[model samples]
Target chain A: MTYCCALRLKDGLVFVSDTRTNAGVDHISVFRKLYTFGVEGERFITIQTSGNLATTQAVIGHLNNHLELGQEPNLYSVNTMFEMAELVGQTLRKVIADVTQDTHNHEQNNYYCSLLLGGQIKGSEMELYNIYPQGNFICATEDTPYFQIGESKYGKPILDRALIYEMPLDEAVRCCLISFDSTLRSNVSVGMPLDTIVYEKNSLHIPNGKRIYEEDPYFRQLSKQWSDTLRRGLQKLPIPTDDYLD
Target chain B: MTYCCALRLKDGLVFVSDTRTNAGVDHISVFRKLYTFGVEGERFITIQTSGNLATTQAVIGHLNNHLELGQEPNLYSVNTMFEMAELVGQTLRKVIADVTQDTHNHEQNNYYCSLLLGGQIKGSEMELYNIYPQGNFICATEDTPYFQIGESKYGKPILDRALIYEMPLDEAVRCCLISFDSTLRSNVSVGMPLDTIVYEKNSLHIPNGKRIYEEDPYFRQLSKQWSDTLRRGLQKLPIPTDDYLD
Candidate 1:
């Protein structure tokens, strides 16, 4: 399992993903799930993938091949973020179809994969999309402003409660880390060494992205602080009186 | 759908459940999911249910009939908490089998139900078990002192972080309510009024349990205070610095 989330704030986009992959409890491995495509001063794109690691790798392979060959419909050639999302979705569907063609139990063989794509095109506004396995996608709106894939529910309440469109980039990053920390504590399948990218809106260039490990001081401090804070807050809530009884 | 959780703490046991039931988006109703049975001064048991309402209701009906008829091998007749869990599990399996026996599409029908059973038998320690759709169940341990069913993930992190085997009954109850509050905010399928029960060890008689409604003043204040505390905690966390960037 994987856990990846992207936030499209008023200022920019934030992408974070865990790098833990497992075929079963015994067959666990670390694999990067975040990929980036960009042209300095023109456009930038980030994708975080979940499900069927082979399929995601194949799709990324196809995209890389297209860029290398300067194909007309590659990520580098797409004019807008919407078109880029469509391209990713289509590529995902094609890869799954090709891989499962010889299987007699196509329905039972779930070679499906999903992705969160977020970026900015030079002349257009920043955008975030959740692309499905069937070549369909939906963009985040002002009310939503975020997309999550993989083990999402454990981390969702924090995002739902704390995220707002106009929050500063740094604050948004803090929120995403807290969300990831909560998930990590609850799920063993989602491990450490997170990949995080912060894209400043309209900058059209990827800034320095961080790879956070368990030893990263800031992350360690944040995790401990959040836990302590929650415990303290819970302790402070007023206990119900006998009036609570029926 | 529902969200029900039970904690087997050292001091005693605590049970909490939401009262939301829905067939579809347009059809929603309130139904209590918590039930209690006991022979005062001898034994006590609490059951919180989730999944198919019909199946759960049928199982409960059978248990009630057994008690009313003074049948052998019934909840009252069982000698140990494990035997009681087995009785409930067997009854659940029987109910599902009866309901789906005539259906040609049994697999598609989904006559599935799950239960959390926690109680004490005279001279035995308190126990908690999570009963599955099949006639099988697992008991909670000191390391994992709580079990949740139906729409559980959204509320799980709090339990994971704050639950302790030795926490006071009131503190455990507070944690359960906060967990329920989180689930209520994120899921439309889980709602209130909530039913809460606190069982003190060796006390066979059931105390006056609380039935909390949306308009209940203490519950309302607790919910508001929790939200405010979480927001304030998030604000107090230190924001990341440029050192976070590569």
Candidate 2:
């Protein structure tokens, strides 16, 4: 399982992805799910993936192959963010088809993978898109400023209450981290060594970003502080009546 | 969809369940998912149901019928908390069997319901069990003193962070409420009019426990206060570096 989130805010866009993947409990491994591509001061696009590692890697491979070949209608060749998302969706579907057709997956293995695409190309607005495995996608709207994939529910409540279309980029980043921390505490399938990127509008390069891990001072502090605050909050609430006491 | 939770604390026990059932988005309706059964002072057990409303209602009905007939192995006849849980699980399985064989369900729908059973018997300690649809159950542990069923993920993170086996009864209850609030905010299928029961250890009867509705003053205050606290907490976190803000 993965927990990947991307938010499009007034100031810029934020992307965060946990680096844990598992075929089973004993077969767990760390795999970076975030990929970045851009030209300095031109266009910056980042994608955070979740689902079958093979499928995601294949899709990324296809994208990279296109970049190497300078193919038409690829991520780099696309003129708009929407077109880029469609190209990704198409690539994902094609790769999934190629792999499943050659494999003998009798249990009807699910090609479950989702992509979060966020960035800004020159002469356009910063955008966020959640692309599905079926070559379809949905963009974030004013009312919905973010998209989350994989083990989403545990961390969703905070995002729903705290997220706003006009939220400052820094606040949005904090909200995203808190959301990730909430999920990391609850689920073991999602682990550390997070890959996060912050893209300022019209700035095509990832000049401000991070890869947070177990030893990252700020992330460790934030996790501890959030847990402590929640404990304190619980302690401050009034207890039930005497009949409800021990 | 439903959201039901139970917390077994050192002081006592807390159980809460929402009242909403939906076959589909268009077929949604209000149906209490909580049932209480016991002889006052001898035992006080509450069951919160989640999943297919028909299956849950049928299970509860069968339990009631067995009690009414004064049958062997009935809830009233159970001397131990473990026996009580077994009885509940057995009853749930019997109900599922009856429904499955009736020839009324065209799709051969398997019974889909989960139960949270918690309370104290006069001679035994308070115990809580999470009973599955297949009549199997697991008791709460010292390290993990709570169980949640149906639409559970949205509320899980807070419980993961705040709950401990040694938490005070009221603090646990408050945490449970916060959990429910989080679920309710994220899932429209889980709604208001929450039935809550708090049982004191060795005291088999609750003198002041009741259902909380949308307009309940304390709950209203709790919901608002929790959201406010979370927002304020987010505000205090340090902003990321302004390297990308350029």
Candidate 3:
């Protein structure tokens, strides 16, 4: 399983994803699930993928191939974030169809994938989208400014409570890390070396992104502090009053 | 869907369950999912259920009918908690089999149910078991002192971090409430009017249990305070340092 989330705040977009993937318990491996496509001062795009590693890799491969070949209507050529998401969704569906055609068991095979696509295009507002396996997609709205894929429930409560559209970029980053930390503690399949990218809205350039490992001091401190703070917070809540007995 | 959890502490057992059942988003109703049986000073047992409402209701109905009939090898007549759990599992399997036998589409029907059973007999140690749809069950160990069924992931992190085998009964109750509150916030299918019970070890009697409604004062305070405490706690954590760019 994977746990990847993206927040489309007023200031920018935040993307975080864990790198662990497994075919089964014994066949676990580390695979980067975050990919970036950008043209400095032109446009920027980031995608975090989950489910069917082969399908995700194939979709990413096709995108990269399109760029190398200077293909029209590619990620680099798309005029809008919505169009980019559509292209990615179409590519994902095509890859899944091609891979499963020989199996004669498309329904049973369950070879599907999902993605979070977020970025900016010149002269347009930044946007974020959740692309489904069937080549359909939905963009984030003001009321719902975040999208999470894979192993999402464990980390969702914090995001639901703490995330805000107008929060500072740094605070949003903190919330995302805390959310990721919650998921890591509860699930074993989502492991370390997280890839995180913070895109400042309208900057149209990819800022410095971090690959956090187990030994990263800041992440270590953040995880420890969050845990301690939660325990302390729980302790502070008033115990059930005796009236509960009645 | 339902969210029910049981914890086996040194003092006794704690059970909590939400009372919402839905065939679909449009078809939802309130139904009690927690049941208790006791022979004062002899034995006490509690079962919290989730999954197909009919199957769980049938299983509970059968158990109640057996007691009413004064049947031998019933809950009141069982010699051990293990035997009691085995009987409940068998009864559950029978109920599911009976309900689904008439349907031709059993594979796709998914009329499965799960249960969390906990309590003690006069001479036995307190025990907790998670009974599966297959009529098999597993007891909680010191390493895993709690069990949750249905919509469990949202509430699991708190239990994972705060639950201890030796906590006081009230503290265990507090922990369970926190867990339930987390689930309630993140999931719409698990609603208010929660049923909770606390048993004291070797007492063989049910203590005062709570049916917490949406307007229950203590619960309302707890919910508000918990959310405030969590938000405050998140604020207290140090923000990510700029060194992350390296």
Candidate 4:
């Protein structure tokens, strides 16, 4: 299991993904799910993936092959963010199809995976897409400025209530972390060492993203503060009405 | 679909259920999910149900028959809270079995349902049980003092973070509503006109719990205030470190 969330805000994009993956509860391992690559000035792209590890790794490997071979419709050769998302989706679908054919998996989703593709090409608007296991995708819009993939519900309410398209990059990162914090506390499948990226809108260069470890000082402080605040905030909320006694 | 949650606290039990039932989104209707009954001063029982509407209504109807006919194993005759839970579970299983036998539903969960049972029999400690579709049930413990059925995830983080065994009953009710508010905001499957019960510990007489409608003033205040407080609280949480730029 994994928890990956991305915010497509007015400023840019904020992406966070946990590092834990497991075949079973006893077979857990740390695997980075976020990747960044593109022409430094002309195009920038980030991918956060979840689901079958083999499928995601194969998709990423195919993307790397495209980059190395300078193939047409590759991440670098794509004309726009939409085309980039389409390219990734097709590659993902092709990979899943090949694997499914090899294993004769007609209905099972053993080779299925999902991806979040976010980036900006030098000329077009910045964009974000949630690519499904079936390789179809949907982009984030102004009214719904975020896309969450995998173990999404536990961390969604905070984002639904607190996030907005105009939120600053720094604040968006904070919100995503809080969302991740909630998930980490409730689900062991989503572990620590979170990978995060803050892309400045139309900047066309991926900023150095952070990897927040379990003992990271700032994360520790934020989690503690948020917990304390929630307890206090809960108390401050008005009590239910006398109608319960009616 | 429905969302019902119950908290087993040191002070008492808190039960809340949204009043939405839908065969499809187009066929939505209002139906009360929370039911209270017991012999005053001797026992108290509240059942909040979710899942197949027919199964739940049939289970309730059977209980009514037991009570009306003065049956030996009726709710009023149950000697302990555990027996009461067992009775409900067996009845639930029987109802599902009867429906399934009629329809030849051997594999599909067409008649499946879940329930939250909370109350006390005089001379026994208060108890809360989450009865499954299979008729097995698990009671709440000191370590885990809550049970939620149907559309539960959206409202779970707050309870996971803030609820404790020692919370005051009024405050617990407030927390549960806030949880419901989150669910209502995120999932259209769980709708408004919530039915809630706050049974005081050791009080055998059932209180007339509130039906919080969409226009209920205090609930409106609580929901609005919660959104405001959450947004404000998000701002107060510290920003991520400059590590992203590292």
Best by TM-score: 4
Off by over 4 Å in 1: A104-109, A243-246, B102-109
How high is each candidate's TM-score?
0.96, 0.94, 0.96, 0.97
Docking category for candidate 3?
Answer: medium
Superposed model 2: Cα runs more than 4 Å off: A101-109, A238-246, B101-109, B241-246
**Which lDDT tens digits does candidate 2 get at residues B186-235?**
98999998888777677777544677889977777878878878888888
Candidate order, DockQ descending: 4, 1, 3, 2
Candidate 3 lDDT over residue span A31-78, tens digit each: 999998899999989999999998899999999999999998899888
Candidate 1 chain A, which ten residues in sequence have the lowest lDDT sum?
A: A237-246
Q: Rank the candidates by lDDT, best first.
A: 1, 4, 3, 2
Query: Which runs in model 3 stand beyond 4 Å of their true positions?
Result: A103-109, A243-246, B102-109, B243-246
Q: Compared with the true structure, what per-residue lDDT tens digits does model 2 show for residues A102-204? A: 6666532567688998888889998899998777999998889899998898889999988898888888888899999988888999999888887767667
Q: Candidate 3 recovers what fraction of true contacts? A: 0.56
Encode model 4's per-residue lDDT on B1-246: one tens digit a residue: 899999988988889999999998799999999999988899889999999998899999999899999987999988888888899999999988877775755554967999999999988999999999889999999999999999888889899999999999888888898899988888899998999888888888788888888999899998888888888887888876677643
Q: Per-residue lDDT for A48 in model 2?
A: 89
Pick by DockQ: which candidate is best? 4
DockQ of each: 0.64, 0.51, 0.61, 0.71
Grade the docking of candidate 4.
medium
Better of 2 and 4 by lDDT: 4
Tens-digit per-residue lDDT, A91-167, candidate 4: 99998888787575555587788999998999788899999988889999999999998899889989988999999
What TM-score does chain A of each model score against the native chain A?
Answer: 0.96, 0.92, 0.96, 0.96
